[model samples]
Target: MKGIIGKKIGMTSVFDPGGKQIACTIIEAGPCVVTQVKTEATDGYNALQIAYGDKKEKHTIAAEKNHFVKANTAAKKFVKEFRNYSEEKNIGDTITVDIFAEGEKVDVVGITKGKGFQGVVKRHGFSGVGEGSHGQHDRQRAPGSIGGSSYPSRVFKGMRMAGRMGTDRVKVKGLKIVKVFADKNYILVSGSVPGHNGSIVLIQK
Candidate 1:
C-alpha cells in the first residue's frame, strides 16, 4: 500500500451515480514532490519521502533546507514517507490525485481536535450517580464510590478518570472514495475523517 499526504479541505455532500447524496470529506491531495528515496540495502528499509505544501525559509530548519535543496525545491510545510514505495519512485517525481480514482476505498489517519480536560461523563460516558427523580442533590455529576468500602480500598491502576480528550492519531478504515477530481487536485471520500478542517491527513490505499 502507498500513502499520500493531504490537507482536509472540509466536507460536503455530492451526488453519486446513483443520484443519492453521499457525505464526503474533500481533501486537497498531492502535487506532492518526491524528495528522497531510501533503499533497503542502504537505509535498512525502503521508503519514499514526499514533500507537500510550501514553507517559508525563516521557519525552515537548516537540515530540512538542505534536504529540499537536493530536490531543487523549497522546504515544504509537511513531509512524510510512504514506506516500501522507494524502489519504484525517485526524487523530483510528483504525485497527484490521479493516484486515486472514483469508487475506490482508502484509509485516512490524522490527529483529532483536542477537547481539553473533560469529565468522566464525557470521557468515559458514565451515568451520574443517584436516581434523577429521587434526592439526587449535587451528586448528579459525581462518580460515586470508586471502589469497595473495605476490600481493596485503593483505586485501581487503570481506572478511568477525568482528563484530556481527543488530539490523538485516529485511523478510519474502509472509507469509500466517492469522487476524485484530478483537475482540481482534490478527492472526496464518503464519510467523515479525523481532525478539524485544514488539518493534515494521510490517505493510504
Candidate 2:
C-alpha cells in the first residue's frame, strides 16, 4: 500500500531505548507531489495520485489548473489516491518522510475532532441514567430507553442514539514509527493521531 500525506505536528515525549517515555505524534510527512499516474490499461486500477498542502493559485480551478499542470506541481492542498501503489510512481514524483522508517508500522488516516453536539456522556461512553438521589433529577446524562413499547415500534437502526459526535473518518491502526525526521520532514508518530492540532493525516503503509 505505501502512503504519505501528513500535517499533525503536535505531541512529543521521546526517550525510549530502555529509558521509556515515548508519546510521539509530530507528523508533517511527505514532500508529496506525484499528481497522477493511474494506468492499468488506462485507469482501470493502479493508483498513486498524491499531492499535499501548498495550494492557492487564486484558489485554483480550471480543471484544478489543468490538474496541477500535468504534475509540474504547485497548487496542492491534499489530493490522495494510493491504490496498489508500491512504488513505481512518476509524474513529478517526490513522496517523502523517507518513505517512513524508524520502527515502521504506520496506518493513520484521520478526521476525528469536531465534537460539535456531543451527548450520551461525551458522545458514547454513556454511564448516564442512574445516580443522583432516588429521584433521579435530570436522569443523570439521559439517553435512556430510546424506543420500544410496540415491538420494533421505531428507533433501531444502529441505535447508538446521541446525534453527531466527532468529525468521523477515523482509522488509526497499528501506529508505531517513533521518530524519523529525514532532515525535518518530521515523522515521530507512536500514539494519539486523529485530527486536531493541524489536522490532515494519512500515513498508511
Name the best candidate (by TM-score).
1
**CA shift of 83, model 1, Å:** 1.1
- Per-residue C-alpha lDDT of model 2 across residues 78-150, encoded as one tens digit per residue: 8989899887979988889887788889889899888777787888889998888988788888888988888
lDDT for model 2 comes to: 0.86
The digit string of per-residue lDDT tens for model 1 on 1-205 reads 7778999999899886789998889999988999999888999988899999999999998999999998888889989988876237778888888888778889999999999999888888998886767766777777777787688878888888889999999999999998788889889999999999999999998
Segments of candidate 2 deviating more than 4 angstroms? 1-4, 7-26, 31-36, 49-93, 96-119, 124-134, 137-139, 151-155, 161-183, 186-200, 203-205
Off by over 4 Å in 1: 132-135, 148-153
Candidate 1 Cα lDDT to native: 0.88
Kindly give the number of clashing pairs for every candidate: 0, 0
Alpha-carbon local distance difference test for all models: 0.88, 0.86
